[model samples]
Target chain A: MTTKAKRSRLDLRNGRIDLSHGAGGCATDQLVKGIFHRAFDNDWLRAGNDQSAFAVPAGCMVMTTDSYVVSPLFFPGGNIGSLAVHGTINDIAMAGACPLYLSAGFIIEEGFPLADLNRIADAMGAASRAAGVPIITGDTKVVERGKADGVFISTSGIGMIRAGLDLRSDAARPGDAVIISGSIGDHGVAVMSKRENLDFDTDIISDCAALHGLVAAMVEVAGSSIRLMRDPTRGGLAATLNEIANASNVGLRIDEETIPIKPEVAAACELLGLDPLNVANEGKLVVLVAPEFANALLAVMRAHPLGAQAALIGHAEDDDHCFVQMATSFGGSRIVDWLWGEQLPRIC
Target chain B: MTTKAKRSRLDLRNGRIDLSHGAGGCATDQLVKGIFHRAFDNDWLRAGNDQSAFAVPAGCMVMTTDSYVVSPLFFPGGNIGSLAVHGTINDIAMAGACPLYLSAGFIIEEGFPLADLNRIADAMGAASRAAGVPIITGDTKVVERGKADGVFISTSGIGMIRAGLDLRSDAARPGDAVIISGSIGDHGVAVMSKRENLDFDTDIISDCAALHGLVAAMVEVAGSSIRLMRDPTRGGLAATLNEIANASNVGLRIDEETIPIKPEVAAACELLGLDPLNVANEGKLVVLVAPEFANALLAVMRAHPLGAQAALIGHAEDDDHCFVQMATSFGGSRIVDWLWGEQLPRIC
Candidate 1:
């Protein structure tokens, strides 16, 4: 049966997406069975129903969604496909949950190369399998030739949160400690370097990876003492800290000398007049924990590969204004307010 | 507190979407709070977290996703917003599941009108509320002008399936009965008339609605005796019936005089050289059930508002070729093959 079906397979080398693929006909069936079914092979997909039905344990479940429209589709360390999977997984991990299943939706432009689409789907499948999660169900649509870019992917994920776990953005206290996992601005700088056509001597790659393992380790060590966790993806650390300060109604004081930043990323930021604080990082996390468990959490984070360069750079304090201030290496203090306007667009 | 926040609200009257709205900064916060929060108000969204977590009973769960790229955004009866909500809810309902929540991802073009965005969100919220399903978590991104049409929305839904029901596409026997909930082709003809600027004397509104209520009634009457259910959306009834015949390895025989269609819709399809069976529908279903229970299910369906025009249009038979033949009003029989290629683009 498999050999018989393979005789009329899609033309992967020279084929391009067209309106017929989205028409819900024989052509649509061929596109789905030929490309998506082969790439994301699993039991649920083989069922071939309008929706996937499966058993789940009775517990608290977490759901998160994100859309990846990152330009240049391909980047230094990862493309949009792998980045989409990693981003959604990290969102689930921020809630101290065990990631379970995912659903994907793709909007492709007509005339887009089938080879590129195949590459993206294969990369996405690899990332999902590596994280122990499966893409159970998905959807695909084709727009006109110029109405969309190459492709835009939207992924939604669900996870299971164990008993007696409570994480909230407004749970931070005045005496909590602030820690960051690994360096900042690596993802933003790598994509920018390619988009701007800059000839930089030093090599920089995106810090795009799934952080569930690191998060699980941290939760194992300090589940009760942890206040909250957030991945600074879009507005970087500065915007995230500001949001936490306002949500928790506490002041944050940081020492700039202790923060971790890659030398190459810092150099690129300096040359482009971009601040490292407002740049994005896909694989890093900002943690707020009780002062007593700060060291234990940092030790556990450092033991993981994704958080090898974890650092404790700040602490919470009581203040009515809920301001976030940084003590510079030059013995001066300044407020790190939320970013005013667009510094980078489509930097996901 | 509400008044203070409203002072810095977005200008929805004459303002246009900009890159800053997707920058994950103060502007992004304003856009989210001012528009989305006001439209889709719920406790889960008010949590202000990256993900939504809640408890569920131990059971089988169903998941489905679809992306809407319908052109003209608005049509006679419904727009893309309402259609998106109805489409996803119906997908879950086909599995005899009760939909719990939905997550949305929107990619808007820069320079699009903010008023239009607000209208779409409000329509989507109303449709969701009407269906008893809430939009819990959502993400928004803005692309450069001309990179996309006005906006594209992707929605994913999760539902809980009852333990005793097992519906599938390949479960149909040789002598099952086929039923359609209501008339077809109204949706496609309505959208086509608007796009082509044809001034039809009679009104032809799209039959765009949520069919969960009708499905629930049918399941209550005949849960275990049902074989499968499908919604004829993109390629309409012909394509969907062809798929079922191929999956179940049976032949289908239908009477053309029994299938209901609005007169204006039939006239429009005839003028446009389109087959009514090939036109899309948003609020209809095709059901295959045990022959003994078909009359009971039809009686229950006719009691509901959405299925007032219900009819038993056809039956399944044993055939090696798995062909779908329709007995025409002219005393002739013809094969209804799968649609060969694109009929109407972006009709979803």
Candidate 2:
């Protein structure tokens, strides 16, 4: 009988993934020990159990999950691996929580390059480490070649909510002030630019970064006054505002002039006939705060590097119909409606 | 402006999944509220926040994740949805943890039938409810046609460890007893029978079940003396036993005559030219316990419906090389080595 120590190392440079790598056998063990174990080297993972057991602090815990199927697994600024980490971390951060750890589930198609898989895992590890959140445990499964896109990653994060902070979507009142952390449409445009059909030249990069630090700063300053926070991801600012308005049962009024948009992203959105308001942004947040704390919160947001482009763009008011109305730069007002359908598919 | 109330209802009967349902827009909202909300109805989901927040009991927590890509999603006893929940829950249960909540992430292929999707979600709801665990958070993403086969579900579960119980894969000591909860190979045979290439008729049903109850009973009876527990899912008894042997650095010796195998499963394995020890069983467990408590634990296992056929299969022994040796019914012994490659792909 061949010992595990005598088994061959994975052909990381030239080999490709096959059915056996996920079949819960020697090959699967080797792939896990060689690739995942190397990338996510931590005590919990090294324990090598079906589950990762750890001691979490006593507090209100938040859980969130997101599945990243972004096309062109490799994108500008970050790939799917990094995006998966940031997206789920941001979800926890939206609850005024400090993300503790993450669990990743990968579904890889048969024949995917081993090198690419290694790169993705490394990126995931780097992102998690940078955010101080580790990928504690994970599961991998492989499908037939035609059954899946190259790869898809689903991540679930658990976080500890800050003490005395209860941020809820319905917590916003009629007099709350609305703020946005940064520019919109960069992530969508960056991914779109890489697509084969779009022929636009732009240097836009996806603003995909863990936002817990900025959230921590905001919580430190205005924990009680902050109504809620949301990252405008898939359907962008328009969808986010509409949802907030509906959930809070209040009308939101914003000035389109105050909304930040990079020149390249604006031009690309115009060329592509996509509204900047409806384009996705990965590293932006829409925040609602009490009217009295609006200026202080804005100042705090702008103090952080991630919130350098922060703007107090809107306010909430009583309306029988919870409409998000925007004062357009064209000297006219229009309803910032919820996105009706698919604007950009697979744009994480 | 069209109000949300004016939107048309989702046609659950005849509608097919489209890109818009996963685009995080009004369509996505409708699908979520109309289908998932009604299925996994709970307070956390009703809050409609990006994350679910709740106070958890202070203790060591176990987090586990699994992405289910079972072929022919609808099996005899259960579908992919229930299986996803059971699989992750079992992972946690193996660590003697009481699963608290679950987060589901679904990746669906475009043009898939909404009726089928609803059925899957309902099955998930029913499974979680029956298990006394709730699906507190979830995500949905749709891919282009043929990018995915039907649907894939990834679930993450967090569970609180039972205070005083610490089950580790490497905790098995020499002179410990190895026990199997029930017969093996039922799940694999059941799935393979439904495949197109295989022409066979049998009343075999997949042993897809949540084994938390049995685990709780074992913890109640032999918590301190239990070394470890593992579900023989993918590579079956051989793979699980081999993993235990390698992790604990102890040799395992078992008599083939004592291993529980249903006559039908044995016949099916014989016809398929497969070893019963190498076929998967979703609801079976291979447990290692101290020799003093082996009989007591086996009696308690036999009392549970899920473990009616509990058997004391083997014993761990000291050896320079950690090997799993089994005495065959023909009075010969052979190494029950780790499975080399894919016996059944997508068996989970």
Candidate 3:
């Protein structure tokens, strides 16, 4: 409140945060001006409008919104900022759409570091640009110092859908085959490693990449074998598989040996007393395909860098209970129930 | 960490959060089963599937996503839950669409009152039903005790865009008039009043209602003249007008007296030393128009209860900097600058 306190704040690095940081005036401006805006400087963001105004390419547009509240905002390979872009872009792409614009609304804790804020914003901007989408407009609000944690990003994305492709979870049909675009649980384990500070003796980078490009590739190849697609996010593969099974009124038979799991993830799960299947994944998709095209789809998926570890793991069968049964690794069988509860809360 | 802690926790209601709450296991399951799943019970939600499968009416569909973390989740007229639905629906409706299915993602603090969450979810469900939309899918995650406030709701909405309405913010044109659907700042003031605990209160409930029906009405009547529409959510009218002005490359001339403001809002602003222009409005919108159809648009908007206070707020003028000059209540003038400082943080 006084010049003395302000001057003392000079001693604190951009890495530190104090009560005054969230004050709704010059202090807050310094945070936005001296850091956030600088790192996120771009034509759309610099315009400083409440909502970004941009041209949507002529066609049917797709819009999606996601809120990112990952704990330990600074994670191993990714943070909440980049996670926001990846999540929203995937939602748009899952609908057979091309992501075009984004709107970011930030809820910041009062005493968050300017440096950390800069890193997050830059990460978001970079991720958006790399995905060929732009962070078009934004809103920022700072709650009391103890009222929030670091920062939370809520993103609303608008995209355009090309003609003809309609993607939905309910599209899965009886007898449809199941395939995974790549290895599962890499992202969940990476974030878990960062949060727990567990020894990452075996470097496990988060598989937190945008999937719109991969979705585009799949659409180009499989015209229609893609009965359904979903990114197994929070509850991971078990949850996604169970969802599709129930939605289509079918049971899935997943071969345990065919499923891909990075050794690091498997090892981490063992240490934490958790299941790799229940862990989160930011860059893997569960694809349901018609039986005839299952192998062809897997081949197409395996061709891409993102899909290099693709696998045909399961098949659909007639069943009202929507069971997700799996052949056990040790040669037994078990029902993979819908991941019944929260795994890691707010881990993006 | 022990079996006693898990079994004993089944009946306790007043206990505080411990570390196991954040651990990914049975503890999290007890919490979701006891609190979240109980509050949000419905056929699709109760199905316990990871993703909800649902249907939609025939037409071009519109989907929107918004996250609400407004401080003091309980406001004058609503909580974060209802606001989440209203905000996302307004976005879809702003596209001249009818909202259909909704999905919600929540980040909740561990000690949040189950009763409060139940009430909020009920409100959201009621709002959805009233808007003729269903919250077909949702998710709940419990953050560590200090990582979040009571709760934050992110809703993704899908709707059917009516035929022939090409609605977009970029659709504003030169010589188009600007109309506000109703009084501004009610929602922002309502939340702020509740937050600050100001005794100076009126029954100034948040004008936080769904605008889809009102939008549908306007779209039916003002079809082509309705060049652009934007709800003044974060930055309020001043910021929204400025955005439209710059987007259309036209300056705006507005009559101060012509803009609608409730008596309570005006009094509250004067007492709090705040400007209503910079306050957010959840229920109000800035509707751009062609000169000739301004009256018809106002008539249509006024026909609805939500738009009863609709008025011609401004008109497009020729200027490059996009100055938003207002004709004062006293017939003099002043520039309505963009909200240069934070009005209220997390005011939603």
Candidate 4:
């Protein structure tokens, strides 16, 4: 059967998409079975129904969704396909849950190359398999030429929160410690390099990755002591800390010297006149843990590959104004304000 | 509080969306609170977390997703907003489940009017409220102008199916009755009319609606008798029937005269040189039920407002070829094959 399909496969290397791909006809079925199904093959998807029905254990469920409109569909170290999967999985993980299933929806341009679509599906499938999460159900729609970019992917993920784990942004206490999993601004700089056609001597790869495993490892050590976990994707660390401060009604104090950034990424940010503090990092996490368990949580995080450069950057304190202040390396303190406007667009 | 927000409200009437609306900063927060949150206010959404966590009843869970890229975002009787809500809800209902929640992901083009965004969100909120389902969690991303058409919505829905209720397209037996909820071709025609700027003397409205209520009513009367159910949305009745026939390995015989289609919709299909059976109907459903309970199910469906035109248009039978034959009103028999090409693009 595999050989038969391959023999009459789509002209992936040269074929252009047509309206029939989204017409809900035999052509649509061929696209689904020939490409999508072959890549994300799973029992739930093979059920072949309008919806996938399955049993869930009795517990609290967490659901999150993200849309990826990152330009230059193919980027350094990652593409829109992998970013869609990783972004949603990270959202589910932020709640201290075990990410389980994902549903993908794609909007493709009418004349998009079939090869590009196949490559994307393959990448998504690989990411899902690596994370042990399945792409159980999906949808695809095609718009006329120029109506859409090359492709945009929207992924929604559901996960199960284990018993006795309570992680919320508002749970942060004044004495809690703020820890960062790894370096920042890698994802933003990497995508910018490709979109702007800038050449960096050092390879700047996107830090996009699934973080549930790291979250699970940390939970094993500091289950309830952890107050909050956030992946600072869009607004970066500065915005994330500000949000936490407001949500918990506490002030955050950070040391600029303690924050870590790849030298290559820093140079790129400097060249682009962008602030690393406000740049996105797809694979990193910001955690707020009780002061007593901060070291243990950091140790657990560092043990994971995705969190090799973990660092304790700040702590929460009581403040009526809920401000986030950072002690600069130049011996001055500055308020880390919420991002006021767009700094970078389509960086994912 | 409302007055305060309104006093400093976004210039919905004239303001254009900027990349800042999706930058995960104060601007993004304002857009969310002013437009999205205000419209989709609910306890779960109010929590303001990356994901929404909620307890679920123990049962089989059904999940479905769809991406809506319909052109002319606004059309007669419905718009992309309501269509997004109705489309996903119907997908879940087709699996014989009561939709519990929805997660929405939106990709908006920069420079789009804030008024249009608010209107779309308002329509979604209204549709969700009317369907008794909450938009529990969501995400928003913005692309540069020309990177997206205007606004694309991806909705993923989760629903709960009671124990012992099994609905599968492949479960259709040879002796099942084929039933349709209401008039076909309305949605496709309505959207086409708007896209082509062609107005009909008679108002033709898209039949875009949430059909979970109708499904629940029918389930109440004929739970065990239902073999399968589907919404003839994109490829219309022809594609749906063909899919069922192939899936269940059975043959279908339909009487074209029994298939209900609005007069205006039929005339529009003829004017556009399209087949009514191949046009979409957002609010309609195609069900295969045991022949014995067909009348009871039709009675229940007709009692609902969305299914006032319910009719039993066909039946299933054994055939090695798994073909779908239609008896035309002109005393001729023809094969109702799967849609070969695009009938109407971006009709939802």
Candidate 5:
């Protein structure tokens, strides 16, 4: 039988995990053949070895790792599986690297639905396919009930940096322009909305996406003009901007009007008393571009699907201590401070 | 001030994190200085940027990521801080790679004791120092109480592989021998013994030393003989060998009496009804070597500090399906199964 056929032999829909499945014998074979190998199909995984061996591209390499612990297992728009894949890929891409391979670690809470896990595995497979990355090696452990949440996945990625690309946060300088791709707060709000007992909502979905493509496009255009790039994930826009400013030893002056925020997100923020600027965005990035190349860079960012809503929001200024200030919508000025308090815990 | 002094400027021991710390402002600066920066002291960290930039070496890179969540914050031999560093470093080393840089992410529970946090940070710093790897970049977040364990450390390591080294799990061939570095069940037993309740006593301390140094030595002496390497962590020796057998499309025949075990570990296993082979190990590895080089490899391993107790326990045999059979101390053969249930959860 073909590999796919063998992988599909198991009754995934109604499957239940038995002790033998985790044992290192025929049962383990059946599990991998019937499930994981099916979803995460590739030459490396099919090597059928405890460790994967493959050729590495020459020159500099970028390696990154991230762990996902979003609760409820299943969520709107995506699951833990896809999130794990995207999170690691984004980390690598943020370094101006082309993601190559991923290693996955699973901490499965006992009694989780086998079907849900299969679904998650399948989702991961789909994400890997889309990202052109593979889940090469993985470790799995099952935790007893009450000891762990449903499931926690940690994914580590390795990517190769293209020659001539020198991206680093310290590269940002005075007069560098600050840019953000798309509206912020979508991911945080979506997860918050799904969280139990938070009974408030607007029409919002997570902007969780694999962003290497967008980054690649930007790299192709901006190249050296792009000083640094960071995904505003847990700490949101304000924190990300502040981070760049501090790294470059420059002050930031952002025009609030130029910052992109979806109307629904703005309203939801108002109701929840959370600033859209401080809300976490899984799919957004804070980019520093030399002022001379801001126009060309903005145009290129706006050209990509992931960057359709990109905007040039701010510029760097000479300052001994990095400071972030914004022109308030009411013709006033305010410090765009980092997230204050536990604004929304576990929002990611 | 140099990066070290700047990092040490904050009050890590007495400081309580507030909203301003998470904010991208002065308070955040203090937090970074007093806590993370000091804990991970290095020139790359002193660059004081959102990311660390460095030159990559001229070889294939092996990268690994791990998240640490050991309850009780601290432990006998090492805390989660050290564990996080050792775990990923050992993982990369298993592939015969030289660890270079690491990225760390911390999720701290709100209201956790500052003193305790500092202790963990110091431990992390010390461990990184001992390993000769730097914590180049890191992130910290304060989650609301009950939203997370007191602390969770996510670490990722990047290492450079030597030019001629081509180690992989699939490289194990029929007639190859398997060897394990030291006794089984030390790490797992140490952790469980520290769990709340089930109060137990023994001189058993965690075998939590970093294995990169030993890996370097082993690879230097017997680079070609080695076919595969794995630190049988969670699922222990039985599961790891089984995985290698399956991955290599071979079967394993291990001499039970030949496997090394501490008398204390054996007694504990007998009393707890646990199979020592199934119990997890942290500071250990199962090495696959060609039969011709097995003795020489053993000599090299024994010459190292971490390998003096290393033992030649098994050999690979041709098999389409992987089977791990043990020659019992009683002069009979029995199947060594993969551990189905987690006898010890979160033992890492």
Candidate 6:
């Protein structure tokens, strides 16, 4: 009867994941205690129960989930680990909530490198700590080789919405001002460069960072004045704006010159024949606020590091068509349509 | 500017999933409205927010998450969809909580059939409705073909524990009686039969079910006397017992003859060279309760539809080694150990 203390340490540097890591046995316990437990290191997780028990504050609760299957698990600036944490946190924060706790589920392909898994866990732990959120409970499963990609992470988060704040997609009004937190297309281009093996003189890094603090700051300054908030992810700014337009039954008018895009991302989009407006951004958020509070909200956003590139890029109007029209730098107007097909796959 | 009402219907019968379905664009909206929305129709889901916001009752909350990558999405008596729902529900119920809401995250392989996806969603919806728990929020991501098996569903569930109940894994005490709700190994054998393409004279159906009602009934009868409860999943009954023994620092003495096993499942396990105690059971639960209330708890469990075959299988004792010893039907004693490796991968 070998106790956990007597078991030898896992071969973290060179060993590959075997079926036992997720078989719910001794090996699985060792993997969890050695890797996941050490990384997450929370009291709730240490309870060793199938579920994490906690107390909920008296307020509206928000819940959201996302699965990260981004290819080339290791991307510039962030990997699937950090992306999984930040993505769900941002989703909850978009509801004007203070992110509370998260639960992670991991599916690892058999023979995946233990070192890589360790790195991903480390990144996830770092991201969770940075955002002041803890991963209270989690599950891990391993599949046969080729039955799964290297690894896929699914994260679900619970948050508490601030009282008196009623933010919803349908809350936008005709006079609302549309603001973006930062440059777009960086996350998509960064992942594409690594996946397609494209190289450029300048580095393109994914803008994957937790935005809950930035959202907290914004909500502090303008609580009910903010109509809605969304993180431009898979379908990017174009899809987000279109969703808002359709949901709110309003039209949007944006100045192309005001939208920020990194030069490397712009060049990559041109070379790849992709629209920068349709590319994803992990760390950026778009907010629609009442006209009177837009400037003050923008000022508050600019004070946060994640929102240093904040800009008011658009405005909503009462148009029967419910279209998102962009005033191009060429002095021509064109509709920013939703992405037609897969511009990029597995970009998280 | 085609509104959702005007958009053409999805080709659910013959169309295959494309990257566009998960692109978070118009196509994604169509998929959501056509399939997910129609299946999981609820006011919170229809709110069209990135996160679902709702009021939670004041109590201790239990949260659990599990990712289902079961091969052959469809199996006898259940599929991955229903299994995903039941598995998480049981996890939360084991903590003596009333399951509340769930959030689903799906990773689909490009070119997968839309019909199958719809079927899975339908099963999930049925399961959610049957359990009285709504899947309020969800996310979808599509990966390139060969990057994913077919579809993997990760579900996170939140439940509210009744006031004054404190269940923990380490709560077992000497003289606690160990009870099992029903026959084990049906789920694992059912999945293995499909995966291995084995035939049997009698049908072996998976015992995947939501156990919240059974737990509630038992809690009503033996509230404080109930030390702990767990569903023997993944590594199965042997692993679950070992976990409890280690956590509570107590030993277990089991009578193998008293443990229930369906003849077909027993035959299947024998033929496959698997131990019945080491196979998964989705609908079953193992409870440790005070000795004085063991009969009352067993009667209550047996009265429930999900626990018709409930039996008292063992008892806890104080031992320095904290081992689980089984008195075999052959009059020999053997230690029950945790599964060393995967008995059957992707068994859910």
Q: How well is each residue in A1-348 modelled by candidate 6, as lDDT tens digits?
A: 544444566999999999887888888898887889889889898889999999986679999999998889998999999999999999999999999999999999999999999999999999999889999999999988887899999999999999898898888889899999999999999999998999977999999999989999999999889999999999899989998998899999999999999888999999988899988899999999999999999999999999999999989999878899999999999988876557887889
Q: Which ten residues in a row have the lowest lDDT in candidate 5 chain B?
A: B1-10
lDDT of 1 by residue, B164-223 (tens): 999988888888999999999989998888888888989899898988888888999999
Question: Deviation in angstroms for B107 in model 4?
Answer: 0.7
Model 1 agreement with the true structure over A59-83: per-residue lDDT tens digits: 9999998989998898888888999
CAPRI tier for the interface of model 6: medium
Question: What's every prediction's RMSD, in angstroms?
Answer: 2.6, 1.4, 6.2, 3.1, 4.8, 1.7
Superposition-based RMSD of candidate 2 using all C-alpha atoms, in angstroms = 1.4
Each predicted complex: what DockQ? 0.60, 0.75, 0.17, 0.57, 0.23, 0.66
Model 3 per-residue lDDT at B74? 90
Task: List clashing residue pairs in candidate 5.
Answer: A48-B247, A338-B23, A338-B24, A341-B19
Candidate 3 structure, TM-score to reference: 0.77
Q: Model 2: per-residue lDDT, tens digit, B1-348?
A: 564654677999999999998999999999988888899989999888889998987789999999999998988788999899899889989999999999999999999999999999999999999999999999999999999999999999999999999888899899999999999899998888776446555578899999999999999999889999999998899999999988899999999999888898888888888888888888889899999999999999999999999999889999778999999999999989787678889988
Model 5 chain A: weakest 10-residue lDDT segment is A1-10
Error of 3 at B26 (Å): 9.3
B-chain TM-score for every candidate? 0.96, 0.97, 0.90, 0.96, 0.93, 0.97
Error of 4 at B242 (Å): 0.6
Residues A122-206, candidate 2: write the lDDT tens digits: 9999999999999999998999899999999999999999889999898889989999999999999989888745666657889
Q: List the pairs of residues colliding in candidate 6.
A: none
lDDT of each: 0.89, 0.91, 0.73, 0.90, 0.75, 0.92
* lDDT of candidate 4 over B232-291, digit per residue (tens): 999999989988999999999999999998888889888989899999889999999999
All candidates: interface RMSD = 3.7, 1.6, 7.2, 4.4, 6.3, 2.2
Per-model TM against the reference: 0.97, 0.98, 0.77, 0.97, 0.87, 0.98
CAPRI verdict on model 3? incorrect
Among the numbered candidates, top DockQ falls to 2
Residue B110, model 1: Cα distance from true site in angstroms: 0.5
Work out candidate 6's RMSD over C-alphas: 1.7
Any runs in candidate 4 off by more than 4 Å, and if so which? A1-9, B1-9
The CAPRI category of model 5 is: acceptable
